[model samples]
Structure formats: C-alpha cells, structure tokens
Target: MGKLYVVGIGPGGFEHMTFKAKKAIEESDVIVGYTKYIDFIEPLIKDKEVLSTGMKSEVERAEKALELAKDKVVSIISTGDAGIYGMAGLILELKKDEEVEVIPGITASSSAASILGSPLMHDNCNISLSDLMTPYDLIKKRVELATQGDFIISLYNPRSHGRPHYLKECIDIIKKYRKGDTPIGVVKNALRDGQEVTLTTLENFDDTIVDMFSIVIIGNSGSYIKDGMFITPRGYKL
Candidate 1:
C-alpha cells in the first residue's frame, strides 16, 4: 500500500504553506483538492496529476484520493487546518482500510486571531454560521449560549451570496447577549496577499467589510482593544 498524506495548506497563499506541507506536495505523485484550493497550491505541484472538483464533492474527492493511493503517494490538500472545517472530516468519514497521515497547518481562525491580537487567549469557541448541514435554530442556540457564557466566538462562513444577511442576523443574535460596543474583528485572506483586518463593534458591524474568505471574531464583554489589537483578558491581573 502507498502512503496518503492529508496536508493542510493553511489559508490561500504559498507563503502560508508549512515546510512539511510543501515537502509532501513535492513528493506526492497525486494531488487532490477542491478546484480553488488546488489552484492555490498549483505552483508547488507542477509535475503531479491534480484532481479538482467543485463544492459539495468532498466525499468524491476523498474517494479519489483513496483510489489514487492504491499505487502512488497521494497528497490531499485542504485550506487551513484540515481538522477544522476542512477535508479532514470527509476523509475520515470514508476512511476504512487506509492508514492516512494527517498533517495540520495554521487554521484560519487561529491565523485570524493572531492577526487581530490574542482574543482567543481566554475561553473561546469556534462556530460556523453556515447552516447547510446544521439547523439554524441549533446554531442560534449555540450563539446565544456562547454570548451569555461570555466566550469569545470565531465565526466561520459568516456570509455568502444567497445568505448575504445571515451574518447580520447572527450579529443581531449576539447583540442580545453582548454589549453593543463589543469588539468584533474581521480578518480577510489572513497571512495571504491583500490581507485586511477590520476592528469594529457589534452595533456597527453591518457598516464594516466582509467576504467569503473572511473570519469574524466577536470578543466577549471582558475583551478589549489594546495596542491596535483585540485581547481577551484571561483573568490574569497584571
């Protein structure tokens, strides 16, 4: 049996690719990923055969990687940490006989948090606003609980085309438990070219900028902005 490396490529950029991830891509005979994600690493996998597909094809993508692993070393790439909202789940779901090695990279949330300061230093929770697989009511409940619990939230897939206002709705829900002046930071293309970070408040979140590639972090009541960055106090009085 050949080796299968499930590598996380970090956010969309060559610089964000870790040394291990790059080496895996360089040594692999086959590369598999979503089309856009595959394109991000295209330069690194010049001689390999790439299998790309559209959204919602994760299961098929995983199967393809497994099949390719029958003879040659295959690298299945994902954006951000493969375990967090990446292809890791799909690969695991379909995994049966193969010994797959998972290589983690900087997740978008962590990168976003780093760029916006250390808002995740204290108790924090990562939430995906996308209700495609999860019910909205359940998501709302979690949002409410996270807000009331005073936990910093890292929101993924906050907004999309048809659900253009879903993020606004989430903000409205968060406002119910958080103060209107709660610090909310938006990080786009984190660690990549054209990276932008916007620090705003819950009340004025609508007026701020956002995109599909953005990660929105809403700090708890105890969170504050210091030295141009959002920091959540972990109860350590200095």
Candidate 2:
C-alpha cells in the first residue's frame, strides 16, 4: 500500500512550515499543487519531481495526486492548513484504497494574527470571500451572522480583482453591528516576501491595498489596539 500525504505548507515561507509537514513532503516521491503555492516551496522541493497545475485545476490536481499515490508516496501541498480551502478534501473524496494522511500547518489566519498581536484570543470565525465554489449570498449571510455574534473574523480570500467589491460589501454589513472604529488588521503575503501588516479602523480601511494574498482580521467589540498591536481580550478579569 502506498501513502498519500496531504500537507499544508503554511503561509508562503518555509519558516512557517511545521516539521511534520516538511517531513511528509520530503519523504514523498512526488509533489503536486497549484503553481503559485508550489513556487513558495521551491527551495525545499529542489531535486524532487513535482507536478504543477494552474488555477481552477484543483480537480485535476487531486485526481492526479491520488492516481500517483496508488503505487508510490505522493504529496499534495497547499498553503495554510490543507483542510482549510486546501486540497485535502478533494483528494480524500477522490481517494480510494489509499492510505491518506493530512499534516496540518500554521494557518494564515493564526500566523497573520501572530504578526498583528493576539486578535484571536477569544471566540472567532473564519470566512472566505472567494465565492468561486461557494455562493455569494451564503458568504454574505455568514459575514452578517459573524458580525452579529461579535466574533473576531479572520477573513480569507477577502478580495480579488474579479470580485473586488464583495469585501466592501461585507464591511458595510459588519458596520451595522460594529462601530466604525472597530480595529481591522490587514496582512499581505504574511511572512512571505514583501509582507506587510497594517492596523487600521474599519471606517478608514484601505480596500485598494488588499488582494488575493491578503488576510484580514476584524476585531470584535472587545478588541482594541495597544502599542500598535491589535488585541482581543480573552475576558480574563485583571
């Protein structure tokens, strides 16, 4: 029996990658993933046979990874935790008779949160605004409900050239419950090259600076900024 490893390589940088994820990728006979994500791990994957696929080719990538795993150790790598909008689910769905293992890595939200301070110290929810596979209405409802619950939101895929206005729309819904001064942290390329982190208020957020590579963290009512760090109090009596 061959092993199929689904590994989350973390946010763009090798330093963010977990030991287990690195081991799995190193041990695998073949690696498969999106071209951009593969480019992030080029240093680690040197001398290893890799199969790269372009955008919207996830199905093909998953199928190929499973097929390759039938006889040898194959790895499907993703940025951030593989289960979170990664290739793990699709590969598993297409997998049959293969021993599969999912190695979790430091997700972008958590990583970006670390850079911005402790904004996720309390209850929080993650939402992706891609709407490629998920519907836009559903994404809006999630944004509305997350805001109503006062949950610190870690927004993934919040903006893209194709759906530029969706993030602004989501922000408008959040304003219905949160104050205009609510702290918002925007991180781009997270720990990767040219990374940038900014602490701003929802009212003054610059949508023009965000892209598909950015991760946005919107703090809840209890959230505040101190010494340029965004903090969401865990409600511990001081």
Candidate 3:
C-alpha cells in the first residue's frame, strides 16, 4: 500500500500554506479535492493527475484519494487545517487498509485573527454556524455557553445563501448574555485575493457583509479596541 497524504493548503494560497503541506503535495503523484479548492493549488501541482468533486461530494473525494493511494502517492487537499472543518476526519473514518498521513495548514481563524490584530490572544473556541450536520438549537446552545464562559469565539461557515439567518440568530443569543458594545471582527476571504477586513461591535455589525468565506471573531468582555485594532487581552496586568 502506498501513502495517502491529507493536506491542508490553507486558504488555497502559497503564503499561508506550511512547508510540510507544500512538500507533501509536491511529493504526491495525484491530487484530489473539491473543485474550488483544487483551483487554489493549481500552480503547485503541475504535471500531476487531479481529481475534483463538487460541494457535497466529500465522501467521493476521500474514496478516490484512497483508491489512488493504493498504487501511488495521493494527496487530498483541504482548505484550512485538515482536522478542523477539513477532510482529515472523514478520510480517517473511511480508511480500512491505507497508510494515511495528515499535513496541517494555517486555519482561517488564525489568519483572520492576525489580520484583525489579536482577537484570539486569550481563551477561545471555534464554532461553525452552518446547521447542515448539527442542529440549530445545539449550535445556539454552544454559542450561549461560549458567551457565558466569556471565551473569545471564532465562527466558521457563518452564513450561506440557504441559511442567511443562522449568524443573526447566534448574535441574538450572544446579545442576551453580552453587552451591546462587545467587539466583533470579521474577515472575508482571509489571506486570499480580494480579502476584506472589518472591525465592528456586536450591535453595529452588518450581517449582510458575511458569507461562507468569512470568519467571524466575537470578543469576550475583556476584549477592547484601541488604535483601530481589535484585541482580547491575555489577562496580564502590565
């Protein structure tokens, strides 16, 4: 059996991709991933056979990658850190007799945090607002718990054309526990082309600005804005 590399390209850009991720892809003979994600690493994967599937075809992509890996080195590409909202878990779950290796990449939360100046400097947890897999009540409960715990939160897949109100519903839950002035940072297409950054408060946030490509950071009570930077202090008194 050959090696199966589950790789994360990190926003599908060279700048955010880790050295190991690039090296793994270069070493692999075949690349498999979602169609849009495949386009991101097109420049690095020259001369290699590529297999692509559409939005809801994650299982098919994993199966194809595994089948190819049996006789050749196959790298399955993911956008963010493969384990977090990536294909790593699914690949692992479906693997029966394959040598699998997962390569991590920069996540949107980290990159967006950097762009918006350190909103994740302290305790934080990441939650995806899309309720395709999980129920909305459960997602709402998690958001409420995160708010009550006062942890800085990174929200992934906040909105889509079909579920435009999920993010707003979550914000309403947060507002019940958090003050209206709590800091919220949003970054769309983080580190990729036409990237956008907006630093706003919870009450003033414009939900129309976010999409599936956006990363939303909601600050705890300790978070504050200074010098046009959104910061969540690390609980250090200096």
Candidate 4:
C-alpha cells in the first residue's frame, strides 16, 4: 500500500502554509482537492498529476485521493487546517485501518483573529453556518449555546448566495444573549489576495457583505474595540 498525506494550505497563502504541508505537496505523486483550493497550490504541483472537483464533491475528492494512494503517494489539500471543517476527517473515515498523516496549517479563525487583533485571546468556539451537511436547526442551536456561554465565536461559511439570511438569523440569536454593541469582526480572504477586514457590532452587522470566503468573529461581553482592534480581555489586570 502507498501513503496518503492530507495537507492544509492555510488560507491560500504561502506564508501561512506550514513547512510540512508544503513538503507533502512537493513530494506527492498526485494532488487532489477542490478546484479553488487546487488553484492555490498551482505553482507547487505544476509537474504532478492534479485532480480536482467543484463544490459539493468532497466525498468524490476523498475517495479519489484514497484510490490514488493505493499505489502512489497522494497529497489531498484542504484550505486552512484540514482537521477543522476540512477534508482530513472524511479522508481518515474512509481510509480507516490505513496509514495517513495530517499536516496542520494556520486556520482561518486564527488567521483572521491575528488580523483583527486579539479577539480570540479568551475562550472561543468555531461554528459554521453552512447547512450543507449540518441542519440549520442544529447550527442555530450551536450559535445560541456559544453566545450564551460568552465564548468568542468564530463563524465559518457565515453567508452564501443560497443561504443569505442565515448570518442575520445567527446574529439575531446572539443579540438575545449578548449586547447589541458586542464587537463583530468580518475578515474576507484572510491572508490571501483582496483581503478585507471590517469591525462592527452585532447591531450594525450587515450580512449582505459576507460570503463563503468570509469569517465572522463575534466577541464576548468583555470584548472591546480599541484603536481599530477587536480585543477580548484575558483577565490581565493592569
């Protein structure tokens, strides 16, 4: 049997990608991933056999990667950290009992947090608003629970063309538990090209501007915006 390496390319930026992730992609005989994600690693896999599929074909990508790994070293790339809402879980679930290595990279939450200052300095939880696989009811419950717990919430897949109203619904749920003035940071394409960061409040949030590429970070009660930075205090008394 050959080897399989699932790699996280880190928000489509070479600087954000881990050394091991780059190495795995460099050494692999075949690279497989989503079409956009494959484009991110284009320079590295120019000479290798690349296989890619469009949206909602994750299972097909994972199975193809496993099939290619039977006799060749295959590296399946996922944006951000592969284990967190990435392809790592699916790949491992299908390839159970086989050897696979997951190489980590900077996730969108951490990358966006860094760009927006220290919004994640305190306790935080990540919730994706996408209901492609997870039901909308469950996603809403998670958002409500995370808000009630006062955890800094990082929302992935916050809005899309199909589910334009989901983010607004989630923000409404958070407003019930937290103040309307709670800080909300929106980062699009994080460290990649055409990056945009907007700092607003729960009351002022405009979900129309958010898309699948954006990450929305909601701050806790203690969080504040100072000098254009979103900060969640970690009890560091001055």
Candidate 5:
C-alpha cells in the first residue's frame, strides 16, 4: 500500500521548514503543491517529479495527488499549518481508502503573531477575506461577531489581485464593532527574505501596505503595544 504525506513547509523560508518535512520531500517519489509554494521548495526536490498548479485549483490538485499516491509515495506541500486553511481539508474531502499522514508546520498567523508579541494569546479567531468559496455576508457576520466579542483576529488572504478591496471592506466591518484606534499589524512573507511588518490602527489600515503573502492581525479591546509589538493578553484576570 502507498502512503501520502501532507507536509507543511512553513511560512516561505528554508529555515522555517521542519527536519521531518525536508526528509519527507527527499524520500518522496512525487511532490505536489501550488506553483509558488513549489518554487519555495524547488531546491530541496532535486530530481523528484513535481506537479504544480495555479491558484484556486486546490480540489483538482488534491485529487491528482491522491491519484498519484495510489501508485507512488507522494508528498503534498502546504505553506503553513496543514490544518489552517491549508490543503488538508481538500485532501480529506477527496481521500478514500488511503493511508494519509499530516505533518504540521508553523502557521503564518502564529509566526507573524509571535513576531508582533502575543496578539493571539487570548480568545481569537481566524478569518479569510477571500470570498472564493465562502460568501461575503457570512464573512461580514463573523467579522461583526468577532469585533463585538473583542476577539483578536488573524486575517488570511487579506489582499489579492482579484479581490483588491476585500481587506478594506473587512476593516470597515471591524470598525463598526470596535474603535478606530484599535491596533492592527500586517506581516508579509513572515520568516522569508524581504519580509515587511507594518503596525497601524484599524482606521489607518487602508493607507498601509498589503499583499497576498501578508497576514493582518487586528487586536482586541484590551490589546496594547510594547517595543513596537502588538499584544493581547489572554485575560487571566477575568
């Protein structure tokens, strides 16, 4: 029987990739992932056969990986924690009669949040602004609730070419339940070269920098900053 390894490469740096992930890729006969992610790990692949796809073809990619895994050892690479909006979901959705193993990696949100201090230490939720599969209204409702409940938010897919204004819309929704002065931090290409980190307020988020590789963190009501890092303690007093 063949085995499938769902590996997380971690935010986009060689150092961030775990030892196990490297070994798995080296041992695997085939590697599959998005083009950008594949490029990030190309040097490690050597002569291994690689199958890369463009954006939004996750289901197809997962299916193809599973098909290949039926006959050979396959590794499907995910950028961050495989469970966090990664290829894990789509792989499980299409997997059947196969032995699959998920190897976890540092999620971008956690990595970015750590760099900005503990903005995610307390009650928090993650939201992806991309409306590719989820509806806008649902995202808006979640944003409203998250804002009202004073939960820290780790936003993924904040900006892309097709959805240029989605992040701004999300910011507007957050502002409705929170103050304009709420702290927000944007971390792009965390752990990778040319990484950029921006600290701003909810009101000024639109004027700041953003990109597809960025993770935007919106602090809660009691969140604060120290030494240029945003922090939201886990309310142990409450």
Candidate 6:
C-alpha cells in the first residue's frame, strides 16, 4: 500500500515552498489539489499525473487522492500549511486508519505578519471570516472572545462577493474590546504576485483593501505602529 503526502505549497509561491514539500511532490506519482493551487507549482509537477478540481470540491479531491494512494504515491496540495485551514484535517478525518504524512508550510498569518513587520510577535489567534463551513454567529462569538482577551487576531477569507458585510461586522465586534487606534495590517497575495501590504489602525481599517486572497491582521492592546511597521511587542525588558 502506497502512502499519501498532504503537502502545503505556502503562499502560492515556489520560493515560499519548503524543501520537504517540494520533495514530496517530486516523489509522488500523482498530484492533486484545487485548480489554482495546482497552478502554483506547475513547474514541479510537469511530468506527473495531475488531478485538479475547481473550488468547493475539496471532498472530491480528498477522496480521489486517497484512492490513488492505494497503489501509487499521491500528494494533495493546499495553498497554506496543510493542517491550518487546509486539506490535512479533512483528509485525516476521512482516513483515520491510514498512515498519512502531513508536511507543514508557512501559513497565511505568518506570511502576512512577515510582510507587515512583526504584528504576530505576541500570542495570536487565527479566525476565518468565511461562514461557508462555520456559522457566522459562532465566528463572531470567537472573535469577540479573542478580542476581549487581547489576542492578536489574523483573519483569513475576510471578505468575498457573497459575504460583503461580514468583515465589517467582525470589525465592529473587535471594536467593542479594542481601541480605535489599535494597529491593523492588511496583506493581499502575501509573498506572491501583485502583493499589497497596508498598515493602518482600527479606525481606518475601512480604507484598506481586502479580498479572498488577503489576510487581515488586527493587533491587540499592546500592538503599535513604529517606523512604518505594524508591530506587537513581546513585552521584552529592553
């Protein structure tokens, strides 16, 4: 029985991809992922059998990958770290008894934080504003608690055509506990083409641009903007 390697091709960039991820892809006989994600690693999978599906077909992809792995080395790729809002969990959940190797990669929060300086220096939490899988009310509740606890928050899938007002609603929830002057970092297409990084405050977050490809970092009470960088200090004695 062949093994399945769930790989993460971080931030949609070959440079951002880890060596182990690359090796896993190279060693695999079949590669599977969402269409856009597969395109990100086109060069590496030229000679392999590629299986790609459109968005919202994760279940199909996971099932196909497992089936293929029964006799051939198969790799299923996700844009960010496989375990963090990626295919690893779903794949593992579906095949509990199978031996699956999950290779980690740089996640969106880390990618966006790096672009904006050090906004994730302190304790942080990642929340997806998209309610496709999780309910909006539950997401809002989690956001409220994370804000009340002063956790640096990184939001994924912050906005989309169908859910235009969700991010704004989340901003309102954060404002209840955070000051208007709290630092905020918005990074679009982090470490990839057409990358845009903006540093602002909670008061002016509305002026920033965000989309499905963006990751928004909302700083905690101790976070600040210094030297044109968004930073959340680790409370070091300096």
> What is the TM-score of each predicted model, taking all chains together?
0.95, 0.98, 0.98, 0.98, 0.94, 0.98
Q: Which lDDT tens digits does candidate 6 get at residues 1-238?
A: 7889999889988889999999999999999999999889999999999999999999999998998888889999998899999999999889955568999999999999998999999999999998989999999999999999999999999999899999999999998989899999999999999998888899988733789999999999999899999988899999
lDDT of 4 by residue, 1-238 (tens): 7789999899897888888999999989999999999999899999999999998899999998898898899999999999999999999889955569999988999999999999999999999998988999999999999888999999999998888999999899998999888999999999999999999998888998899989999999999999999999999889
TM-score of 6: 0.98
Candidate 6: segments with Cα more than 4 A from true spot: none
Candidate 5: tens digits of C-alpha lDDT, residues 40-90 = 998888799999999888988999899999888999999998888898888
Q: Which ten residues in a row have the lowest lDDT in candidate 1?
A: 203-212
How far off is residue 79 in model 1, in Å?
0.4
How do the residues 1-238 of candidate 1 rate in per-residue lDDT, one tens digit apiece?
7778999999877777789988888989999998989888877888888889899988888999988887789999899989888878888788877778889998988989988988898888999978888998898889889988988999998888867877887788888888887899999889887898899888778623787889999999888888788888889779
Q: Please list the C-alpha lDDT of all candidates, in the order they appear.
A: 0.87, 0.91, 0.92, 0.92, 0.87, 0.92
How many collisions between residues are there in candidate 6?
0
Candidate 5 ranges beyond 4 A from true positions: 236-238
Error of 4 at 141 (Å): 0.8
lDDT of 6 at 13: 88
Q: What TM value does model 2 have? A: 0.98
Clashing residue pairs, candidate 1?
none
lDDT of 2 by residue, 166-232 (tens): 9999998999999888999999988888899889998898888889889999999989999999999
Cα misplacement distance, residue 113 of candidate 4 (Å):
0.6
Candidate achieving higher lDDT, 1 or 3: 3
